[model samples]
Target chain A: MVSSPATARSFARQEGGAGLRDSVWGARELLVALVARNLRMRYQRSALGFLWVLLNPVLTTLIMVGVFRYVLHIPVDQYWGFLISGYFAWIFIVHSVTESAGTIREHSYMARTLAFPADVLVISTLMSRILEFVLEIILVASLLAVFRHGGVPAAFALLPLAVALLVGMALALAYPIAAASVFFKDVEFALPVGFTLLGYLSPVFYPLALVPEAWRDLYSLNPMVGLLGIFHAILYDGRVPPFSLFAISAVEVTILLVIGRQLFRWKRSLFAEIV
Target chain B: MSSDVPRIECVGVTKRFYHYEHRTTTLQEFVFRQLAGKPLHVRTPTFHLEGFDLTVRTGESVALVGANGSGKSTALRLIAGIYPPTTGSIVTRGRLVAVIELGTTFQPELTGIENVELYAAALGMRRREVQASLSSILDFAGVDEFAEVPLKYYSSGMRSRLAFSIALGSDPEILLLDEVLAVGDVSFRAKCYDRLAAYAANGGTMVVVSHDMDSLPMLCTRAVWLEGGRSRLDGSVDAVVQAYLQSVTSSS
Candidate 1:
């Protein structure tokens, strides 16, 4: 017989702002619940459920190490450390983009009934991947400890910021891609190929210093260029990334986020209808 | 904020749905469609809800009775704010909760209790708020035995009961339900009636879309007959229901 007062008050306000606050804060907790849900769903009913978190990167790293260190004969010092750190960050961007693209469309049922912000579907999917990323970071740390490259540089203290930048890069890409995927299913098809191409463009396997000086600035425009560059500086070299690198990355991320937010907000209204 | 003002108001609300051929939901389809140079058959955007209007005052229960595709659910959707009107405006007051499709928000892979948290969170309820009512919600759903198991294991009836329990816990002032009353077992239906009777007694306004004629007079004070998205009759339950029944029989 009783009625909740909060939503009524918000509706009575006659403006859009009041209700938005509920969603904004409400999504924060939902994010946690969803992340937890995804992790449980992923690992459910398997004896080696938790082990897969550790095992996935281990298996992937073994293949990459065989291909890059032995087959390609790339001459990078501490290639083991480089491969995992770079690989973990790259996987975050790649998985976030691919998964976020389908998040809204896949969860269309919720869009038809529930009133939570649609973008959180994209955001929470990214958060779940980020949680996986955090687990994989443990792998990176162990590898770094085992490799002891240059005694694990002092700049490694900035690992947290490096992770943030990687996540930022994912968010920027996920926003636009998630919205576009709803209207054009081709987005989902193109994303994995796009990420593969993006891998060669970014310094996933090789070092950025190796790319010629003339191409470096143009390459730095990739956003991930600066993001991964900082990641390499901290985790690989144990030195803080140059402020100039951070500056350009900061600009790129800002512009990317602005464009992403604009596109997502513009197209979000049509989603319930078209989806 | 005046006592006389209607809690929910729809003014000339018309919603159009584009009828896409081949859907063209992919870039490949779109490109192919463009290369085809605009097929001879051009589909015009059609209005599902054309010039529809309704006003439900506070403390009133209205049942929307219509045949399939008669815009019963569409009207409920518009009031729930799931879809915006293509033209005109809809102004709503008071807290509202709509249950259009049961289990739409459940994540089947999660445990029953976890799904409760997830569903409540998606419905815009804060965590501590759900936490305070957590046990009570579980009790009401009567699925506490399967709470720790993944929801995929639960039967459809259990899922619907879970969804209804979460919606009921919200205690919304305005409840927009679309064919949701026949949610659970016979015992649950009786329980729903007892609770709904109490809810109506507390001055809650509700708009329900149901074809269950026998339950009309017992559940609602007013009945709105919508034909093709337009309000055909809006009057006391018995009068409008009788008119609608006559129209159906004569047309058939």
Candidate 2:
């Protein structure tokens, strides 16, 4: 059916928030394609293919478990369980942020030629990482059920909320970082160091209790501190996180998302020219 | 909704590209500049288009003809909404598909058919639509035999033919072509011309950028000759092409 010229004009004249929504909503298929492209490219030539998605986190967890449990001997019961519950969540953030940082530059060709929302590139990167994270979580949950003597905990039901919160946080950071990377090539190079620092700073392998009492307040200030705390509570302790912790993280994620989204939108138009 | 309303309207459009002389593309350099009280980067604006105006009514097939750096491609890019005009406004009615750089969006590692799906999706074709057109797209590209082969294994001509096919598969209301006919063998080029002529005959609006002057009259009824960053002439394809050729030969 032919659309009225007035309807076409409205589509052409859309701007600011409304335009952004339209672009994203209209390009939903493109988003799915981009996510599929990323996943396909990642596993395209590899011998193991999809196995790496499952094996990667499991292997990393084992190495961390061996070091912290056997070599370093950090005292924590069901250490592997404790490690993976929080470790998987941390890896999700790390992978998403690191990959998102370079997403715009890597897909510069599409950005330059195609008229889709640039945000889709960053969002799809996060989506693909989220898919992998979901797979990793399934692996972690099943392992916890078998080894912990108690089948998957009741709090496992809250895993989706936890995943949602983590995804929000990842997206919140990713938007600005991806935009910044387009302007400054440093973002791509600097992200590894940042993630490395963030990994050690957040309680991925060790418990928060292990940190000296004096540093706890400052360390808790890290958004991941509260986020990982929830992951550990649900998957490690088989209990709900404190209401205060969940509330604070939610508020923080929302605020960061607004800021990141604004920064991305402001910088997005310049991308085709700059990249 | 009225037929009187032009399908495309560009009034006083201008685009400027900043060519950086000394740019800081790293945080380290940026921070050091801040500490040293120096500007982060120095750039000069180069106008690619200045007060460029165009209007295309329904069923009008327009060709932009120009020399290198004459901004014909930039004009098409602006019209395609790939780049926002630095000044003025552009209003385009209907779905637009631009075949600017063929196969640029295709992944070399992906199979020919996979790339076709990816490209079609990028052009904003729905999954069902893409699936419906899959066989026809492959058939037109003449890459059906190597549909399962990775794009890297296909020749450059095959890759572009497939790209062209996918872009057309969207069945866009407005089609923007940038020298796409330059690719593929003679038979394929003829097939493309036939398909495009059919598209125009069916009332599809088209804006094409091509250096192939001979093909312009066959494809477009009207032409705009751009000089520097502005439209120098707009008239029948024959008139504009004749003027542009005379200018080139006189200059040479």
Candidate 3:
């Protein structure tokens, strides 16, 4: 249908905006298709093919658990279980953060050609990592069962909320990183180092108790302290996180997600030019 | 403001792109530039097209004919909504699709059929629509025999033909076709032109970017001649074509 000239003059932005709003329903299917395509292409043409999915986490866990349990003697109880939970959470964060920054830079062509919301790309990046993360979870579960270290905690009902918060945290951090990278290529370098330092600061490989008495509270101020602590609680200790700590992490992540979304919308328009 | 809306209206449009004097794409160079306190090496903004005005009414078939670097392709892309004009405004209604740089979404590792879905989806068709039309698309391209083979194994012509076939299935209200008619065979090229004529006859607006003067008159009711980032002339196809021919021959 032909629109009047006044409305027609504003067509580029407004019409595309309406098309985006109308197609919010399509976002889910598009994201699923993108995730499927990425996963397929990732392992495509390799001789081993889909075996890499199972072998990757298994190998990483084996090497790290062997090193810490035998080589270093870190002195944590049930170190195998601890590393499984810790590494699971750590890998998701690291993989998602490092790759998310380049998501826009990588799919710059699609963003220019298709008028879909740019957030779909960022969310799909997270979804692809989440799919791989799901595989890691399966490996962890089977290994935990095999070793007699795995059991559902009493607070298992809350596990879904905890997982949601972790996803929220990744999305919060990833949105800004991907959106801003279009303006400044420097994000490409800063994010990997930042996430690496974050890995060391969090109690991923080591126990949280290793932190000294005076600094433990200050260190808990790092949001991941509470976030990963919940993962530890559910998977390792069979206990619920302290309600106060859990609330703090959830609130922190919600705030970051809100701000990151704003920054993303502001930056989305300029992407076609710089990308 | 009129009651009738043109399919596309680009008024006082100017697009300026940064011309980097140095290769500063790396982080090390960025840091060194900051440490040394030198000016950023983007020398200046060069206008790809400046103060260009165009209006394509509904059901209009327009041709942008220009020599290399004359901004015809840029104008086509602007109308296609590939990117916004750096300055001024463009208003377009309907589902716009630009077939410029086909096979951008083609993954070499993907099979021919897979790339068909991926490229069509990238052009704004839903996955279901792409699937529904996949057989017909393949049938027309005559790549049905190798649909399961990886695109990397296909010759360049095969790849383009597949991409072109998929693009044809993308239901666009306003189609932006850049000089992509060079299919693998002459029959397919004829098929493409026939489809083009049918689409235009059915009142589908189009902005065709090509330098071929012979084909220009056949496809366009109106022709625009562009030179040095300006709309040098726009008139009926025969008049503008003749004028453009005279100018090129007289000047050279």
Winning model by lDDT: 2
Tens digit of per-residue lDDT, candidate 1, span B1-252: 455788888877777665656456777777777898865334566667788878888889999998788888877877777775666667777667788899878876788888999887766567888899888888888998888988999999999999999988876778888999988899988888787878888888889888888887888999999888798888999999999999899999
Query: Taking the tens digit of each residue's C-alpha lDDT, what string does model 2 give over A1-275?
Result: 21121222222342221122247877888888888888887776676878877776667777878999999999999898899889888888888988887888999999888888898998998998887789888877887878883776788898999999999999999999999999897887788899899889999879999999999999998999999999999888888788898899999999999999999987787788789
DockQ of each: 0.36, 0.43, 0.29
- Note the residue pairs that clash in candidate 2: A5-B1
Cα error of candidate 3 at position B103, Å = 1.5
Query: What DockQ does candidate 1 have relative to the true complex?
Result: 0.36
Q: Evaluate residue B229 in candidate 3 and report its C-alpha lDDT on the 0 to 100 scale.
A: 84
Reference-based TM-score, model 2: 0.94
Residue B189 of model 2 has an lDDT of: 91
Interface DockQ of candidate 3: 0.29
Q: Which ranking of candidates, highest TM-score first?
A: 2, 1, 3
Task: List the candidate 3 regions with Cα displacement exceeding 4 Å.
Answer: A1-11, A14-29, A43-47, A108-115, A142-151, A180-191, B1-3, B22-24, B27-41
Per-residue lDDT tens digits of candidate 3, residues A1-275? 11121232233442431253234454555666677677778776676866876687778888998998999998988898888876887778778877877888898877665556678778877877776776676666556555644455465556667778888999998888888788777888887788889888999888899899899988887888888888888767767779987889989999999999889876676676678
Task: For model 3, state the Cα shift of residue A124 in Å.
Answer: 2.0
Find the candidate with the highest DockQ and give its number. Answer: 2
lDDT (Cα atoms) of all candidates against the true structure: 0.78, 0.85, 0.76
Colliding pairs, model 3: none
Higher-scoring candidate on lDDT, 1 or 2: 2
**Local accuracy of candidate 3 as per-residue lDDT tens digits, B64-142:** 8878888887777677666566666887777777787766667788888877776766566777888899999988788
